[model samples]
Target: MKIEQQYFENLLEEGSEEFELIFRSLFKEKYENLYSLLDDTDAFNEPMICAAFSTPIHIPVEQMVLGFLEPLPSKIDVVSNKHGVVHIPKLGYFYTNEPCESLEIRIKDNNSFAIFKSDKEVELISFKEEVYINDTDIEICRSEDESIIQFFPDQTENIQLESGLEKSVMHLNNAYHLIKKHTPFYAEWLNYTMRRIVLFTSPQLNSFASICTLNNAYINLNNERVSDIFFLEEITHQCGHALFYPMSIDRDKLFIMDYTTPMSHFSGIETDDRDLINAFYSFFPQYTGNYIFDVILDHEENLDEDSRLELIGRYAFRMYKYGLGIYQYQEYSDQILSEYGKEMFAIFREGYEKLYEKRKELFDSLDIKDQVYVFDLEKFKSKNLQKTI
Candidate 1:
């Protein structure tokens, strides 16, 4: 399975229609019979439908496929995307209006079941998970089935879940506008890849810890004061990993070893090459977002003084991680990337180098000594205020 360099490069490029078609073709091949059977369903044709096959949080593809083996109104266990909504195979969806994990639903039993609503045809079931934390109820943001943005209930006294969720959503919207305004292709790429955003509290992390698998991103928001630029960096970084996962499904095509090798858990232990490459690749887009922020801070006016300074500080913090990621992964890439993978790595490195050169002056202006790994608003503002902000 000798894939071309263009295929690898296009996958990293983030907005290649050709690569999207390639992904669909590969996905179809993986589930040939199932794909053909449910080709006409609206659920199968969604832009972000690939998200359903992701690990940890996913609508089980096997169960949906198995549902087709039975009759039209078969009994199948389906998981809800948000709280109470479930998408049935062949038939439409049903709502339960409560927290749910998985429930058995009668697809189209006219005689044996009662309709919950007149418009949609789905039989309701009796299975609900209580949505509570410390005897307090928390709200869930139920967006469309294609994409969901959810927040974890407050765990600590300092944690303000409602305010944090609202502000994070605003930052996500603003980040999309920045990407669209600067790089429209990147914005479209984000729409196609990112499916869910989960904001939670993590006391162990100083500022935050964000990790993404497939279309889902889990962001720890233990820190109170997060800048607008922080969202820009994490959104792109997490989504970048989401996009890269499917592309590397065929291990022989991209890597010398099995690409699905689990990451090392022990401290100072070497991780698999796949993890290293993906980590470095995720930073490529983060740097692109940084580049966009630089342009925004330089040209865009009427921004609040504090906001500008905040962005500059976070931008500097993100830039350090972006550079360090690529530097750490350079040796691993040389050891494990196949011929096609090498070409892709070369292209990614070249892209980062270009952005680095352009941002040289901005880098020189920042006080590197005061810059910290975790986002510190005061430290960032104090050290990075040398500029016109």
Candidate 2:
């Protein structure tokens, strides 16, 4: 894992004269260690390394490299020098460093550039600007007023940022505070797993928030359709998806294999199919809702009964959404028990029923209008369970 500091220093001191030899040796060693750490050896190819480093989450790459390298006198600023060449000021430079005729810079931005190199020619491959918030790099296109249009760098053409995007970011930060104060586990999980939240403008296509496991990020639409509680719900919900990544790594797949049919749920009049992993993941948002309710109830002595009721109702609605999913997937509980055992199933079923009961009690206590507003059970009913994929 250790990178030779003296060698890099010598490379920098000698500049282009020693660039080819130093870069080939240094980059090969550094990338091998990084690939080993990530459990991904294929990414060490020249094209893959170029692509990975150009993306926003390349901090993980920086982490792997810097983790073993000797500390420099000051932070090395990243800069591009020539075609297919990037200079890490005071550290060293990386380049093809060969005779070339046709050179192309595909894209050039302030922070990074992409280039293509061969023995005959070096060319600019592409370029992108990365925005960093709180030292975490984000892929976003900014407006004149500094408003953000966030999207995954790879899918910029398919997605666009919505109007009032700034407001959504504000709400996201507010939800982060609520999570940090109320759900310490989610807060901690997010610190390690969750990478970024990409915002989309089209409501018809992205009415509900979603998480993608491959990127370790959330993709949410800027639809002003729900309360702040909903934002917190999505945050915790997506964090749950992120949590499953590490949790599933060494686990047995028997339960999922046995229960391969998708579970149905309703967002409005439309029905959607959720896979076995997602059906199980529903437990997380329900757990998050219960945790938020507990935190509020812990301060019940200082609040009026009306305030308490409203808070409980809001969180209960969130819990009910996930509880309903669990209810729909209950038939597969035995399969889960068979694979994971009785104790695990018991713990899951307990939380599942507890949320259902709590939602029932909260709904019954409300007046007819409040009940109508809070308990939308119409969304939970599945017309058919026999449909298989």
Candidate 3:
């Protein structure tokens, strides 16, 4: 049987009680039908409803409480927890989990160093006190300078410490809170992304999947509600980039676009250029089916230079190629360009005239005059450059 099925069965066998209690308790009001359906975890994985069904399932209890309702009334001021303090909104101070360490996070609440011990026990410490911050044990944020004591992990990205709070507090505090609250969900999310769909990878990649949230951009799971559902879909998109982010984006090694010289690489869209479009077509015939590509390359048939460049950001051949490696290049297509072969990549030419105008418009608007990397057009055209048949 498929692993998906096995996963469902396991949920039923072991997760039934937890699932029922959690579902009923949380969805008692808004999602009555969905809560009722919780009796069958197996049915929840149905294809059509899976997307819609799973959408709401993402709103775990704390997310609901933290995201929607305020856990506490405005009048209350103390926020305490043994499980660790998660700074909830008007829910102002609700400790979702117990504090693991006796972390004394000091914050300036009322012009005084209101030291927080385990999300509870607020103490006013004198500025003159020999307050030594335990980098590993406690996280501190005050006067706009929030810091995780002295955390400078060896492999972390090196960012210059800017002055004040921007360098410290907010992000780390928020990240810690989000990661603490959503560890399980994060693990499951990583599992979904790294499962069968990750056609080719190494243990390093599998490990990297867990560390994705560590990227400051996605540190806080709650902020993923930007574009459509807060840029959450974009999260997967970025992870897709990360999953295949190669040291060198080369067609010989990765799927991508090819262009020589920094200036010609992406300064502007080469409109109605049969050479460029034909080159694009020579690699990715799947563009015929991609809606976004179709809109930019196949639909808007009469775009000028300015128009084409504007839509440049939307049309990334590498992204399309990544999709190809993911869904198309595998078992789906028999077409061979050899090892890294593409079937003539001629499909992109079929709608050339029709797509030329719009595609140029997209390319024209883009200001990519600064990609110093020696980007190979074919390499630039592919998605995941690390796969082999």
TM-score of each: 0.61, 0.52, 0.27
What digit string (tens of lDDT, one per residue) describes model 3 on residues 1-389? 00122332343334333433433454546556544534443222111122222333211222223213222212222332222343322112333233433334343444233445546754333232111112222212121011111122222332222222233344333322332233333323333322111111112221112221111111122211112111122223333232221111233322233322222133244442323222332232222223233433344554454333322323443333434333322342233233332322322333332344444554344333332122222332243222210
The global C-alpha lDDT for each of the candidates, from Candidate 1 onward, is 0.51, 0.41, 0.29
The better candidate by TM-score, 1 or 2, is 1
Q: Given candidate 3, what's the lDDT at residue 277?
A: 24
Candidate 2 local lDDT, 1-389, one digit each (tens): 11122432332234322322333444567676544443422222221133233333322344223222333212322223223234221122234342222223222343343344432334443322323223232222222100111233333343443232454665566556666665555565555444335455543344232322222334355433433454555566655554443444323443634344454432332356665566665564456456665565554354444334444555655555655666655655665534553344445567656655745654444333333332332222121111100
The segments of candidate 3 whose C-alpha lies over 4 angstroms from its true place after superposition are: 1-115, 118-236, 239-310, 319-323, 326-389
Candidates in descending TM-score order: 1, 2, 3
Would you list the clashing residue pairs of candidate 1? none
Worst 10 residues of 1 by lDDT: 130-139
Error of model 2, residue 375, in angstroms? 12
Clashes of each: 0, 8, 57
Q: Which stretches of candidate 1 lie over 4 Å from their true place?
A: 1-9, 12-37, 41-164, 204-213, 224-227, 247-275, 331-333, 368-373, 387-389
Point to the candidate with the largest TM-score: 1
Model 1 Cα lDDT, one tens digit per residue, 54-103: 32334556444432343454445556644466643323345566334555
